[model samples]
Target: MDQAVLPLSPTEQETSLGSIVPPHTADAYWLTPYGAPGAWSTNTTYIVGHSWEGRASPFNNISSLSQPGDVLTVTTAEGPVHYKIDRVTTEYKDTLKDSAIWDKAPGRLVLITCFMEDLGGKNIIIQASPLPAA
Candidate 1:
């Protein structure tokens, strides 16, 4: 469950690349131009990674064990941000760009990873919102 979050490469950031094939690493990559945690109060923050089949990986548990109401913590330089899972679902790869994942929601956290069981055709998407301040 512990993995580093890497920033996109300069080329990736400049191009705003959104690839289904994740970087060749076990860590997650922050989606560029989307703003980092707490950088914007109303922009969705996307973190993408890979789900390896037949092997343990950082994102593997997201699809296999995550559930609604679960707490997802994102560590940032400023501090940690906590999100309460709202849903977990899968979408066919070809149509994901047009799906509801791109909706503009304030302080939304979205995690994207390949669906290990259907790597060639599907993606697992987890959506959550910032935990209300205590």
Candidate 2:
């Protein structure tokens, strides 16, 4: 006989914004760690920042998403991994260095989404240090 698969509990279902992706999106193309499942499916990401009023919106604007402290786990082209969170602020959308968040840094993880509000709006950014080796 085949066993049944139960759904994840509410607490288990909760995940960070960086890990959550739009529904129906293909996971293979996502900028997440290889070998590991997608962040949204695994719920490995955690929420570090929140709106000033502490309100949580599932689909918040980019500005509202970048509160500070958000985190993300990512896979590098070299196959290494890293994490990052907001450490500094620059011009909203016009900034060029924003992409630097993904570059190899001392940290092992970096979180990026959107920020501010503009034609394309700003992106939420995060930079996280890697966890110690097991």
TM-score versus the correct structure, for each prediction: 0.86, 0.34
Residue clash pairs of candidate 1: none
Give the whole-model CA lDDT for all candidates, comma-separated: 0.79, 0.34
lDDT of 2 by residue, 1-134 (tens): 01111122222232222233323211112233311322222333322222122343322343444445654344444443434345534334445343554344433333334343432544454444544333
Q: Can you tell me which runs of candidate 2 are displaced by over 4 Å?
A: 1-29, 32-91, 97-99, 116-119
Residue 123 error, candidate 1, Å: 0.4
Top lDDT prediction, candidate number: 1
* lDDT, residue 9, candidate 1: 44
TM-score of model 1 (CA atoms):
0.86
Error of 1 at 110 (Å): 0.3
